[model samples]
Target chain A: MHMADALVSPAVAGAMYAASTAAAAYSVKRVKHEDDIKKIPLMGVMGAFVFTAQMINFTIPGTGSSGHLCGGVMATALLGPYAGFLTMIGVLLIQCLLFADGGLLALGCNVWNMAFYGCFVGYYLIWRPMTRRRLSGGRILAGSLIASMLTLQLGAFSVAVETLLSGVTKLPFSAFVAVMQPIHLAIGFVEGAITAAVLLFVYQARPELLDDKGKSGRQNRFSYKRTIAVLGVFAVITGAGLSLAASSYPDGLEWSIQQVAKAEEIEAEGGGVYAAAEGIQSATSLLPDYAFPESENRMGTSCSGIVGAVFVLALCVGVCYAIRFWGKKRIK
Target chain B: MSKIEGAVRELHRVDSIAGADRWIHRIYPSVKLILTVFYIAFVVSYGKYQLPRLILMGVYPIVIFILGDLSFFDALRRLRFILPFVCAAGIFNPLFDRKILFYAGEIGITGGMVSMAALLIKGVYSVLASYLLIATTPVEKICFSLRKMHVPAVFVTQLLLTYRYISVLLEEAQRMAQAYALRSPGQKGVHFKVWGSFAGQLLLRSADRASRVYDSMLMRGYQGEFSCAAVSKCRQRDIGYLLVWLAAFVALRIG
Candidate 1:
């Protein structure tokens, strides 16, 4: 799922951008270390292939609707995770700029959701495990299906969490999750089936491409556990840091908690933990009551604000056209 | 098949617009890129109830659209697919938030309604800001700027190559899709049974094309290093543009 800029707060967006950029840098280093210059063109072409492939939709049986290829797991299957992730970055960048399929600010989140999970988690956890012992028709199909579905599930869940954290929407967390997950489950199934079909076909046509026997040495040296541990720590640190930043700034996180607090009637338990947390929240809240001081002339001020906004917009348009007109006259 | 063709046409439209001769297009690509990011951040940073301030942020895109000599309707038309999703994202706001914020001529304005409007404006503003950046800056120049900003060469190279070849692959896919559609009359898409062969054939062909592309690169004495023909220096005007936009953004955020 492509997250729009509206769905993410600056804090969440910045954290995601940092995470995805780090991943891209790491992928670049890994790909360079391989020293196989041949992969550059292949990655490029495959990136384009994924781009075009996404445009070609196939109808799901009995659904009357259609789905297209996501191509993360499929790309990683052909190219390793590192290259696949980078290729995805390329495809997504083009999509953002050329078609505006996803927003630029949200590109980081989109990449992590669509690419990181599929390329890394889908590959290491599901695809590799399913096809580890040997390559077979059933293994290829099962691996693609499971990997696609699992990754889509993770991606969809992340989207729900991110939107909730952003607080731009009034959607309750449970309600948002309830809607996002099932829809993606269906999408994931279709994606999985298509991925399976493609991978199986490639396996039959050029089995050598799917064979990882030759690259086992390089692949084994890269420990998934160590990478995951490092990433886990990074995420934790970023989360804590962002939460602190968000608290001081009174951002979406605080707003969301307030919304949740209002929506759910929680009895104030006379417990040490509850008291301490409440104390912390009040201490950290920029607006302790989450509203500005009421003024007798509040209506007047709001009316003035709206009037000023309209005036500013008019002035902006006037200046723009004025300058354009002036420039054309000067040229003439 | 029409979807593929439509996408290719959209890509060309953006490319052609980016290549247009206009003051916005003439500015340094990196400057436009940075300003767009700043503008989006500024718009998104406002509180959900800050509808007035959010409305003020509309000035940036409106001015850019006029100065760039672009049609607002065309831009909106291009964004038709995404605008609905953005709007729908905040549709539940009014329901979840019912606290009255203000009164408008005997009608009470709830916080939810205000926030929903704010969110919709934020989405529109952010999308427009991004569209402006790409509409003004060519993809090549954008990549070049990325390289200058210390983005890795490998990634930049991949971006350029992928951009270059997207049309080629899209055409091939279109042809293949047409053939399939013709063969499977009344079918919605290629049958699931033939998906493997359909997409598989495309994949195999793409791989073969990649091999040939690599061969051509090697023959041209490519050694993994890409050189740009034109190097864009940050002129004084570009700096002025950046400073002006930064000042405006700061003023908007604080004013």
Candidate 2:
């Protein structure tokens, strides 16, 4: 579940952005040995692949709405916790920029809540141990299903906790739980099963994939530097890149709070909110609130979306080339 | 095709105010990015119970609304959908939290009330600020701004690529969803079994796509610095704009 712009406070959103970027950079650095040409393509392509996979939806059995693949778990399984996490960031970045899925401020929350938990916690805490213990296709399936569901649940819960802590949503714990938990539970269950199936399938077909050591070979301790550097760049890029796609909406938590909290509490133009808007007004320069002013045009969002896509593509391609150029220089 | 066309059509349908373009759209993307940082830092750092301060929090962004091209009501209409979450999250503070803090005339605003108020305020401020920024600037400009900011060229490029790719994927997803709906409109959502199978199929397909993308990189003169044709070059005004915005951001954060 993506967080929208409406439900966030500048404070919580900023803190999360900082935290997520920090973690993202850390993750990239963690994949030091894997920063070779082979991995580069995989990283970029896998990021794209995640997008396409999300496009095709699968029915959720009894539910009328279909559920698409949440790539966090799959990425973690293949790319290791660190790389997987960065990849998930890539996925969310794409969603925000091109798809108008998440808000700019909410991007931090989404990256931390949705991506962090799905890749790292799900992989290291649950999937790894579970899969390792059994090492069977069924184990991979079961592990992924459980990990994915748990991760989503945690991410959803984190949304509640973060919102509550940030004091953005007025909904009390009980009522908010009543609203968020069940819906997410449904989503989580479906996502988990989907994640499990993918994990199982991959395990059967390319058993060596997840075993980084078994594949091209693990990077030595000396190469750890690459991981840190790559991750640092990844975080900054995503933060600045998909920023164009950051929405003007309230995100999931804020939307939920507005539902439970009545009118007076949820005044749209109350001087209270208007005051803070001015500060932000002082703050934003380029994209302002991610969308242009009313005087622009109807196609603002789409125009912004197209711009964002180009931004991300260029950023990614640029970084790769720069590195290649650097590598060649060092060799010479 | 029509749905895509509709999105395109809707873009052309709406019209913006006069000075809106120069003030909002033409502003450098760096201004938006920095301001976002400034605003988020302010909102997230506040504790859950600072009610009066929370109420005061909303003024800054709303005042911007007052000055900007977008009317207050339009901004609210655009953001109202997300209010429920933050609003609801705080409402429960009163129910579980029985200890009352203040009795304001008829209403008894407790610690929960304070917390809820803070949350609602936070949600509102962040939402408003973000809305105003996006409403003004286009996405591509933001990327160029990021590049100018020296935000790791590789990362910026990936972001651009990823953003472009997702839309294609979304269309693909939409197509797949349409196919799915056509096949199983009568049936409930895919069963868990089918759901897993379908998702797995997507992931595997993604992996293949990833491999193919990697190959293409070699074929092209992919030396790694990801540049784009979206922007021709920087404008002379870009420097002046960035400086003015940076000054304002500092003033707000310090205050």
Candidate 3:
């Protein structure tokens, strides 16, 4: 389910870039974190493991779309919130450049949506509480299912929101969310099962791995203070600079859907014979995300640029606080 | 002076910037990343209706591909692995996108043709840009730039360590596969159960070893920051490299 470059607009792309840069900077800060230098290997190892795992594909039954594990959720399960996020950044960056799985311009969005939620929220809210002292297979299974689904849902929704704000999509918010959330929900379910399987296998053979990491102690996990500072500085620059350069047009899919829908509604929207032909593809891309918007007729790309940066940073802050709140309430 | 430079050179060869004894290896990754973004941004901005702009955008990267200094034939060979995904994604575009945005005289085809072409260009252009960047820049220099840019000390450290360990784990996986091949040697050789269990075991072992290695690294005063590479002082000639591209981007954007 990779988002294509053709699917994103410049405004949305810029904004996401700003947001992602901030997140990346924040992640670097999050990982090195005050002196617990051991997290370095933790991040690298997890990234490598995830990369290898992704290379090993699994069949998807009748669909025949042999999808591999995304590894974000699994990373969260193994690493704590902050470190998990950093590892994912590594994985996504590597995947984009070396493997060519996702787009360069779209990398920021993909990493943030897939990694951010899967790492922080998935861990603190679901995995941590359930897996806390006495781990249960049942708890792991249930937590994995819920957390994975929720993470995908948020990611899908974020794509929708970004598209809309960038003015790319023509679909109403509710309809778009309805279409995106459920499909991603199915994908997330399958992903969680695989993650649980991998971990369960490890647990059965060697629960000592966790103990080993824990004993590796202050060196292994990450330093919070310094990581946050470094990340915070980058995020600030990205958020500020990106905000200044964003475009005003609607995003890609949004523009097409809106145009086709408008043409169908009015007999002479484009007033051409090709009008009916446009309807067919528009009808098929009916998934809420079909509303991907590329703003075509906008005047100022600059104002939207500023808005994109501001909104992404604000959204990230919202997610951080939301996960913290979720963890506090859920964990004993 | 000569003694210190030699030691540093040896240390660099042994650790970061693996085999980066070429000219293209000197460009900064952030510069590459910036240019790639700007390139894609310009490509996607043209209304789907603008054919000339689209075609022109597609050509710019091809020029870079030629200039990137890699053997033309070898460069194309590198694209063999990449071609499949681009083909897969593009193949679907025309089939799914039958909207006749424009008609080519008589025999009918969908706008998906243009969309497919667009997707292919986007794919090829970005891939070419990245190939140029990675092939030229030593991974270490990029990490070093990241450090100067204040990327968290930990993230940068992990990228380097993870790269180091990839060889270690890959060797282990390779050996395990070899042993498996020797044991079964036939259809049974590729059994999922055997490979699955083997991968699982390797994973746990690697994790444990990595943790140990990390602990020792910490003991050795690795405070997460690498000494930024002393790139040869930027010469006036370097302006030719940076400016030529900047000029190209502006010309493309406004033209």
In terms of TM-score, the best-performing candidate is 1
User: Model 1 chain A: which ten-residue window has the lowest total lDDT?
Assistant: A286-295
Local distance difference test scores for all models: 0.82, 0.60, 0.59
TM-score of candidate 1 against the unseen true structure: 0.90
DockQ head-to-head 1 vs 3, winner: 1
What would the per-residue lDDT of candidate 2 be over residues A42-70, giving only the tens digit for each residue? 66556766765654455665556767667
Docking class of 3: incorrect
| 10 residues in a row with least lDDT, candidate 2 chain B | B10-19
iRMSD in angstroms, per model: 1.8, 14.0, 14.2
Candidate 3 residues A287-329, lDDT tens each?
2111223433221122233234344445545555565567568
DockQ of each: 0.59, 0.16, 0.15
The full ranking of all candidates by TM-score, starting with the best, is 1, 3, 2
Compute the DockQ of candidate 1.
0.59
lDDT of 2 by residue, B81-167 (tens): 456645555566766666665444466556666666655566566666665665665545666777788765545555555554545
What is the Cα-based TM-score of model 2?
0.64
lDDT of 3 at A239: 54
List TM-score per model, in order: 0.90, 0.64, 0.67
Interface RMS for model 3: 14.2
Candidate 2 residues lying further than 4 Å off, grouped into runs, are: A1-19, A30-32, A48-58, A62-69, A94-106, A129-135, A153-187, A201-332, B1-23, B43-81, B93-118, B135-138, B147-150, B228-255
